[model samples]
Target: MAQRLADLADQGCPNFFDSQRFGKDNSNLKRLAQWINGDINVTKRHEKSLLLSALRAAEFNRQLGQRVQNRTWQTLVPGDVAILDGSNSHFSVASVDAELSARAAANDIHPAGVLPGADDSIAGAPPLLAELMQRERLQRAYRPLRLRIQQLAWQFVADDLILTMRLPRGAYASGVIRHIFDLQSD
Candidate 1:
């Protein structure tokens, strides 16, 4: 078990926003779509903010999921936005060079996915997400496609496994856990 956990740590995990971000049973997403279509009204400022956040998160997940499925989530590709490790700083990748590849392998940087917003270009964005960005007047953003686990350690004690690791803010612990275990909710 420890070996398996260590392997996962070395491999890192997909930097996906946990399902909880979308609210129970993805209610927030449902509400956001309803609000967008004028089928429901979101009057409270806080509620509106939550819905918007969920909207952005959902879009980010969609883009990230695509990369994961394509097996490119951990590697650089032309036109990718690469975020420097441990910082929000990012730049567009015109090409993938040897140095960039080394940095990515060492966890110095990671490929980023778009969080669509009003200022973000609609090019390359899915039609529905682009329309939502235009409608919501959102700001452009990017998130890393892979999350590196820091200070990872684990131990087994009498039929239980204990794991410890540090993650950057906004990175989900479940993102790591999902790689090693199947999860269920009560």
Candidate 2:
């Protein structure tokens, strides 16, 4: 069991925020919008936290979707903050050169998207997005563009394929599973 745990830790999964953070029908997000627009004042700390989480998740998902659509989620763009795989350290790419592109392609590093927070380190996203964030009064933060899967294995049993793996904190198992199967949630 100890060895198994060690192996799982050695291989980390992609970092993604799970759906639990977003309430059903995104009601929390709607409430957050009301608060941001000054239509409501959130007094409870828990409620405020939920709203903040929803907003951050929404922003991160938007950026990730954009990158995936452009076929550049695995690639890097200018002014992108690239995080080294399996490590927390990251750097800003002011320009895309051959070496940097090669590194990104090799998964040595992946581009990160802003999480919309108060003290973001780098600032190079689209101006329109920035404007929107400004209007929403969100802070700036960075999050990786890609989610990595490691030590992935599966087996079929009784008409079910059991998948076994480990994911790093912030990565969602459902997010990974959804990619493999068309699942419907109740």
Q: Give the per-residue lDDT digits (tens) of candidate 2, residues 1-186.
A: 334334333433234566777877778877876776668877887787678778788768877777767777777889899998877788989999999988876668888877766443224443443343554466566777777666767666877777787665677888776645535555
CA-lDDT, candidates in order: 0.83, 0.69
lDDT of 2: 0.69
Across 13-32, the per-residue lDDT of candidate 1 in tens digits comes to: 88989888899999998887
Per-residue error for 32 in candidate 1, Å, reads 0.6
Alpha carbon lDDT at 172, candidate 2: 82
TM-score of 1: 0.87
TM-score of each: 0.87, 0.74
Give candidate 2 regions above 4 Å deviation. Answer: 1-18, 119-139, 182-186
Regions more than 4 Å wrong, model 1: 120-136, 182-186
Residue 22, candidate 1: alpha-carbon lDDT:
94
